[model samples]
Target chain A: MLDYKLLDALVAVIETGGFERAGSELGLSQSAVSQRIKLLEARLGQPVLVRSPVLQATPAGQRLLNHAQQVQLLERSLSRTIPALNADRTRLRIALNADSLATWWADAIGEFCREEGLLLDLVIEDQDIGLRRMRDGDVAACLCSSDTPVAGARCVRLGQMTYRALARPDYLRQHFPEGLTPAAFRDAPAIVFGPHDQLQHRFLAQQGYHGRFPFHLCPSSEGFVRLALAGMGYGMIPDHQSLGEVKAGRLADLAPGEGIAVDLYWHYWRHGGDFMERLTTTLTRKAQGCLTV
Target chain B: MLDYKLLDALVAVIETGGFERAGSELGLSQSAVSQRIKLLEARLGQPVLVRSPVLQATPAGQRLLNHAQQVQLLERSLSRTIPALNADRTRLRIALNADSLATWWADAIGEFCREEGLLLDLVIEDQDIGLRRMRDGDVAACLCSSDTPVAGARCVRLGQMTYRALARPDYLRQHFPEGLTPAAFRDAPAIVFGPHDQLQHRFLAQQGYHGRFPFHLCPSSEGFVRLALAGMGYGMIPDHQSLGEVKAGRLADLAPGEGIAVDLYWHYWRHGGDFMERLTTTLTRKAQGCLTV
Candidate 1:
């Protein structure tokens, strides 16, 4: 049988990009690292590393690297979670889009935790960036808008979130009689969430308009909705998030037929604590109820 | 921090159902089991067991039991898979349903393995029962019909499979002109895969017919389709599975509008080797191409 210490040594060398650096980091003699690699190759009956002036990982080494990283992550998770498993303390951490957080995800997580008797830590961020945080081990799970999962992570489609261009009814009435055209959109002010928030920009671009908006940046989803409700500017909002406002005539649809649809996905590390599993289940069920498909 | 030994001790006791039996099995004294359980309870701040005369698991203990079994399975898997990670041995084990094996899964797995320079070990069985084998640490993964994943297993919905009630054209012609009325099906002979196969039963029940069939039992999906093709009896067959026969006029639809729809779910233990991930990705892609939904 190959020694686990040898596997660790090989992984360390691969990760650090050289044997000498790995040895220094692991506090082992350089000869010991070499011997471990040689013995590992002997046990596996094949060479794993491609030794050169600049270290390079062979296909086999790359495969091992993937598994080693997963194992390391699992170990860290086990260390943090096992203590709580034995104790009455059960805390779940989940990353979600601010829109979803303000819309339905909190109620879903709260209801599930209440029934399951769990403590929850909710991390809210933009869906585009939340998935990266999930992959980096910052959060146990996330609800994001991408089907392509990060390497070493798992993903499932929660459902589709449809966005409609909206503004306050008074703003729409003041801005147009024949309805706003592509030419008029350039001069109009818009409320955007952040710099990377290109939903309204994309909707405008699709209509052959390339124009900058006088900006009112509200980073929070609730804040943006409130700003729009107060007749601030035109913006894009998810149907579920803006439905109540639209129904009450506080926010009026700008172009109802031209909506942007982005499907949401639940992404998480392949291996983690039960908190990840519970959160994924709750989010998936809630998304099924809220989204279109 | 939890001592990993405590989890092992709890699992042994649960598996054996007694302190003495678990102690003997783990090569420890009964007092050791008692002491470990006491320590575990103290560390967790709650009792994991309910013991008067008989040993029983509390809800918290049951949760730990699930995690314990997963840890044990993963430990074994790590022992087998970690060493092979950097080995020249190009072998992979894949578990899948017999129907898909006979149809498209085998070719996909074979092509992927060949392209990736891997030797394949295919395990084919009924989709329903095969997942248990995966949970028992026998196989790496499985293609099953469960949407709710097994504890400690990951699941993905491939798509929905639509099965048409199929029969030999001659058999249908001889059986009825009313075209699969409730009366005709009450005494009709049907081909079923084996015991516990309920596709036909459920389809008939939906049409308000409570009747038993003179069943010709064919266990394998290929064999069931063969039996139906040989004019033994009518059976429900997936459109992909029976497409060739249906196109050749060997089989005819008995109730096209009242077909059965079964959504297939792919499941694998969270700690299986890389083969599980590769197989899941390939199977999900292939199923999307083959299934209706």
Candidate 2:
């Protein structure tokens, strides 16, 4: 059996990004934390952490981290039933994409979080790649576009978010003086969320242009809309996020009838406890009202 | 003279994350890109990149990247004057915090970008640590709270942004039912932008509490406001962002009359040419109108 005391030290180091801060978080001395790590490595017969360039978990460390998180989840659920248990408000570390957070996520889960007295540690990632966070054992669960689940995880569809190619009217007048054309797309700058985001590429390809084009890379979802409204670039913005701006005439659809619907899924450990089960129920119920079929 | 061809290959590799993508961006074959990197490495007599785990430039590679970006800036300025030269619109890579980007940045610079036909590649970072992006040669310039300039960089004050600890009225009623006290603060859940963000810590310390407390780790500035509105936790939000909500009585200040003012400064290369110079002027002049001193 592995010792959780040592695992707690490892979790602290990763979360706080250093030994000193981890020591403070765990209420242990720096040297004591270091000793615990050493003990863990000796017990495992391999190094579990990579300390140079950046402090990150080795493959072995990641598996252990996932186990620790699962155990923590179970404990929290147990505490709810047994009042004598610690009952400290537990934080669930989860990975999610920004578009959802900016649009419907907080509204969907906020009430449940408040009632359950649960705190969240949210890691923002692109929807297509967010599953890697769960695969890497860095998060207990993740909301991503992928329907496939990791080995021990289960996934459920949570509806879809529809996106339209949007731009300012003046921007269209300036860049697409002729209307949406292959030539216009080749010349007009586009706003991409990030390097990992392929929505713009997919949208452009769908429009029959697959060549190098000028683009403005704006990572924040809110900033992405701002850039479009500012006439900086045309981009794919979610319907939920741009309804008001679109109605106000601050933004207009570049392709009126053309829209892309990205399917969203909730991926969690199959054995994740009553808390996870209830939270899943809450998210599904809320997402249905806000998201499209 | 150093071979710009080799340098371009290095820059493209870092920006695009691989040799194949670099080839596509630079209009060269994959092997051509690889050979250039090898030739550059041979000339430098050391590795310019760390390929394992993640693709990032080495320290020497970073210096070269900075040099290449500076050269690109100079070339773009020259091209603007001499239109026969390549007049392709240039994308300026800059680092800035999310709060500024969400609030004043887009509005302030949107017009300038549109007029100049410039595209932006923005990197979102915390204000306190944004300078490291410039130091590491990861960006052409950055907006940060520190007035100090990196070596070969010039900085200009762009006024200050004021933040207030804010929460929903009902959240305050539930968490601080007995008025704002040290005990109440110790128990109330707080929202922190990230681990690197010290705004909440500083605000709590100012209110005379220096102990570990529960906080929701939310990285998105927009989401942070949403969480506060959803009654998840109280957090320090910029006055510009929360003004409407606060005035509408959806959210209220936890500590009235107390505000933390973070000074904003524009840091850019000293010889960054006309583009950087004009950008600095525009930011300073516009910041005065929107940001509080």
CAPRI docking class of candidate 1: incorrect
Candidate 2 residue-wise lDDT, B1-293, digit = tens: 99999998997887666788789879999999999999999999999988854577898997798788778788888988897898557668889989888778888888888888787879898654468778777678898888988998999888999999999999999899987787898788898887667788789879887656778888888889989988899999999899999999999998898989999989998788998899889988988888875
Worst 10 residues of 1 chain A by lDDT: A84-93
State how far residue A197 of model 2 sits from its true place (Å): 1.9
Give the distance in Å from residue B80's predicted Cα in candidate 1 to where it truly belongs.
79
Please compute DockQ, using alpha carbons, for every candidate against the native two-chain complex.
Answer: 0.01, 0.47
Per-residue alpha-carbon lDDT of model 1 for B1-293, expressed as tens digits? 55878876886675455677678657889899889999999999999888742466676886676555445445444645676544332323345654564454533443454344343334555665566566555455567677777788898988877788898898798666677676677555676654446687687777676543344444456546655665656888888778888899989988767788887777777665455566578867866666766
- Ten residues in a row with the worst lDDT in model 2 chain B? B126-135
Candidate 2 positional error at B30, Å = 5.8
**CAPRI grade of model 2:** acceptable
lDDT for each of the candidates? 0.65, 0.85
Q: Which segments of model 2 are wrong by more than 4 Å?
A: A9-66, A127-129, B6-65, B127-129
For model 1 the TM-score comes to 0.37
Point out where model 1 deviates above 4 Å: A1-85, A273-275, B1-293
Q: Which lDDT value does model 2 have at A131?
A: 77
